[model samples]
Target: MVIEFDAELWLWEARRDDSWTFVSLPVEESEEIREMAGGQRHGFGSVRVRVTVGSSTWTTSIFPDSTRNCYVLPIKRAVRRAEDLEAGDVASMTVELVDI
Candidate 1:
């Protein structure tokens, strides 16, 4: 989900393995200009982080679920539960926009 107010778009973050991917947010250097020009400026932003035994990553997402705003990792072999990670562990994530 995306929060848009007077052209300003506020998107939450989503987490993947090594890097993060968002729906509409620009990650590539080439798209930076287009993204900045398309929307109004935002004051602050946040990225979601997931931590595992081996490593940690963070990403931004477009989800608006207040309870689950971030794309959490599934409980599996590579991705574990949130409780399993330590305080310092980190993950990568990104944020973008989603059209309803």
Candidate 2:
């Protein structure tokens, strides 16, 4: 399934030194993805996906976040640079479930 949404980029608190950035999937879409991805979860309950932000596209995994009740997609440095994204910025994204 393909999902599209706008989300704010945020730095992962635990990885502040590493500058790990991410965007949370919408609650409704997260629920839908959970249902659709049942029995397909990998390590850390992550679902593989192909993601697009601006002109950058790459394959990654979205991990379930119990604290937020959603999945979080990591934004790699390369993609961030290619798209000119930074923390606190609002990004329009497209996520497509893959290898499931």
Candidate 3:
């Protein structure tokens, strides 16, 4: 799945405790990825993907946890890269993290 963000809004506010706080950090619209892998019951699958922005490349993953019955993937590095990339996007490699 590839999530494209037009822009990210970062809002800050001052707290009553004499500290500054982040009010909002909005990310671009999210995209969904769906795939089925062969396994018994309790298994996991992970794929290493590469996200490219301009000339930079970041490694990422898609993890499916069978025990939890859910698939989750974090784009933390991609989000951070958004800071430097506005006209950039991501590309990924397909691989299995685990098979049981």
Candidate 4:
């Protein structure tokens, strides 16, 4: 299934403590995805997906965040540079939920 939405690209603070960057998925969108992905997920409640931001598209997995009640998309430094994205930047993303 494919889910598309726009959200601000924000860094996960605790993750950054370990030097990782993440983009948050809106709560509503995450809910929809959960329904669609029903009973299918990987380690850490992660759902595999192909994500696109700006002109960059890559395959990755989004992990559910209990604190935020949503899913967080990991954005590597390479992706950030290719998309010219930074923390707090609004990004339009398309998520193709794979292995669902």
Candidate 5:
């Protein structure tokens, strides 16, 4: 199944020595995905997903964010350039839950 939404890209540093940028799935969207998954998840509560942003499409996983109580989509450096995405820039995204 395919899920679509819009969200702002943001930077996150899970570790002090490392940093990554991510796009968070809205609560409504995340809940929908969880319901569809039926409790299937990998480590860190990550749900495998195929993501599309702008002109790029790739496979990745969305990790749960307890603070926000939502899921976050990591945007790779290559994808950021291809999509011309920047932190704080709102982007229209499509996420397809994988291994369902």
Candidate 6:
């Protein structure tokens, strides 16, 4: 399944000293994915996915965020740099389920 959306890139406040950037999937879409993934969920209820932002594409996992009741896709520094993204910036993203 392929999902596309635009969301703000935010830093994980829990890790203030670390640079962990992420974009959250929409709540509705997250629910769909949760139902679809079913028993396929891996550690931390993560789902393998191939993500694309601007011209950068990479494989990663989206983890379930209980606070937000959704899945958050981590944006690696390399991809962020390649796509010219920063925390608080809105990014257009494409995510395709890899393992489910």
In model 2, the runs with Cα more than 4 Å from the true position are none
List TM-scores for all candidates, in order.
0.19, 0.95, 0.28, 0.86, 0.87, 0.96
- Which residue runs of candidate 3 sit more than 4 Å off their true CA positions? 1-43, 65-72, 77-100
Error of 2 at 29 (Å): 0.7
| Residue-level error in angstroms, candidate 3, position 14 | 24
The parts of candidate 4 lying over 4 Å away from their true place are: 15-18
Comparing 2 with 3 on lDDT, the higher-scoring candidate is 2
User: What are the clashing pairs of model 5?
Assistant: none
TM-score of 5: 0.87
Model 4 scores a C-alpha lDDT of 0.83
lDDT per model, in order?
Answer: 0.29, 0.93, 0.34, 0.83, 0.84, 0.93
Badly placed stretches (over 4 Å) of model 5 are 13-19
Model 5 Cα displacement at 72 (Å)? Answer: 0.6
Best candidate according to TM-score? 6
**How would the candidate models be sorted by lDDT, starting from the highest?**
6, 2, 5, 4, 3, 1
Question: What is the full ranking by TM-score, best candidate first?
Answer: 6, 2, 5, 4, 3, 1
lDDT of 2: 0.93
Q: TM-score for model 3?
A: 0.28
- By lDDT, the better pick of 1 and 2 is 2
What would the per-residue lDDT of candidate 2 be over residues 1-100, giving only the tens digit for each residue? 8999999999898875536999999999999999998898999999999999998889999999999999999999998888988999999999999977
Cα lDDT tens digits for candidate 5, 1-100: 7888888877886533214888888898788777877768888888999998888999989988988888898988888888777788998989998888
Expressed as tens digits, the lDDT of each residue in 5-100 for candidate 6 is 999999998887337999999999999999999999999999999999999989999999999999999999998888888898999999999988
Candidate 1's TM-score: 0.19
